[model samples]
Target: MNKKYHDVFSRLDQKDKDLLREYSVKNTTGVIFDMLKIFEEHQEFKFIYEEDGKQVNLVEISEMLKAEPLSEYGWIARFSKHVKDHEII
Candidate 1:
């Protein structure tokens, strides 16, 4: 992984860290599915199309979630809002 990416991952909160660890250990497909489940309810979470015509995937989303320059409390609040808006656990 890139150093910047690794740095981002290293700074994740406990819950996000746990999720990353779990997803890394499990099937990538399952991880993607779970991400979609979360994203579906969060309008702010959307696919970013690249010039190469590739759609953003779960790994990228996870990286973003981990790297967002917000306080732990802010991250949780946003995450909770997304969950509540989408009725996701």
Candidate 2:
């Protein structure tokens, strides 16, 4: 898993793109690079979106983020999203 901006952009789905659009975020390499830089410089910097009543972080970690169904003790319990949106947690 490469950390290059292109690699991240490649993995972005329509939902991800829409999230970025809602924030007026540009997909340009330079912008993404700067955003990553900001994240690296600030420990508290986070770009978050609420989906399924759960927070999805786009900056802190990638592999651990997902858009899953909300539950009292699902992935949200670990602050991570999952791909299954229909299973009972």
Candidate 3:
């Protein structure tokens, strides 16, 4: 895992960590990946998975999103659409 990712992952709460793990397992990379990709395009991004420890940070994720140019309505619409499309499958 990249150092930056490790640092970010160290800050996740239990709930967010669980969600990330679940998403990884299901190969479902929608909203989270979208957020990450946005950050990655501007900055750097990485993923870290640890067997016996938490591997991501919700606060950092929040901060990254906050720093991005995602409009509130647009993000919600995109996320909603992605969920709706996924549910149809």
Candidate 4:
């Protein structure tokens, strides 16, 4: 694990760990970078799962759709979409 992202991955649960394993256990934090580079363009996390020939997705809702501002919407959803979902980003 890279020290820079230790704080991020540290906060995730075991299931999320398993999800990251789909990326690779030796470099799980790569998914975060993928999310920033790819998913941000579409408002949700998605990447090619080449072995399975399908896109793996992360559940993320736009703060604008929620009733609260970013900080308070975190009170409701960080990753809350139901579409082709895997876990909260």
Candidate 5:
């Protein structure tokens, strides 16, 4: 937490702080699954990709699940995404 944003966080009322704390702990995990479900319905996955030596982010690509069950397929993904800024954390 930076000193610049300390006032912003400190100004929150107890109710607001409680709500934010609850959401941060409870809803964080669901966010990923919700996004995945939405993308499954849309038949696409948005990810970063490299092109011409530059990383193009939020690139939408179509995907299909492999025929085999995940257990049989060993839950393999063709590629994984890494957030450059969040790598250390």
Candidate 6:
């Protein structure tokens, strides 16, 4: 695991961590990166799974990623839909 991402990596549940580790071992590129792109674009942590059969929302994931050093930057921006140019507030 990369030291830079240790905080976010630690925030994940063991199951999620294990899965990420497995992906790291099995893939050199593409799959995991694509998955990250999809996750960030979608902005959801529980996007890949359900808890007690309930769907997870962006707010929860945002809170989780908020403390990560790089999460508050561009990496998360890609997940958000910019409507500021269209919506009049």
C-alpha positional error of residue 22 in candidate 2 after TM-score superposition, expressed in Å: 26
Candidate 5: 10-residue stretch with minimal lDDT: 67-76
lDDT (Cα, tens digit) per residue for candidate 1, span 36-63 = 5565557677656466786775435664
Q: Which residue runs of candidate 3 sit more than 4 Å off their true CA positions?
A: 28-89
Per-residue accuracy of model 5 over 43-69 as CA lDDT, tens digit each = 456455678898753324334322211
Clashes of each: 0, 0, 2, 0, 0, 0
Runs in model 1 deviating more than 4 A are 28-89
Q: List ranges where model 2 is wrong by over 4 Å.
A: 1-27, 63-89
Residue by residue across 1-89, what tens digits does model 2's lDDT show? Answer: 35697788678987886676545523343354555566656768776778889996665654322222123453444665433542222
Cα RMSD for predicted model 4: 13.5
Off by over 4 Å in 5: 32-89
- Per-residue lDDT for 1-89 in model 6, tens only? 58879878778987887677657634633454555556565644444446899776543566433223223364434555545442211
lDDT of 2 at 65: 27
Whole-model lDDT for model 2 versus the true structure?
A: 0.53
Q: Write one digit per residue (lDDT tens) for candidate 3, span 1-89.
A: 79999888789987787677767634543555566666556545554444667776433566455324345454444554444323322
Candidate 5 clashing pairs? none
lDDT of each: 0.56, 0.53, 0.55, 0.48, 0.49, 0.52
- What TM-score, computed on C-alpha atoms, does each candidate reach? 0.27, 0.32, 0.30, 0.25, 0.31, 0.28
Candidate topping TM-score: 2
Cα lDDT, model 4, residue 86: 40
Best candidate per lDDT, number?
1
**What TM-score, to 2 decimals, does candidate 6 have?**
0.28
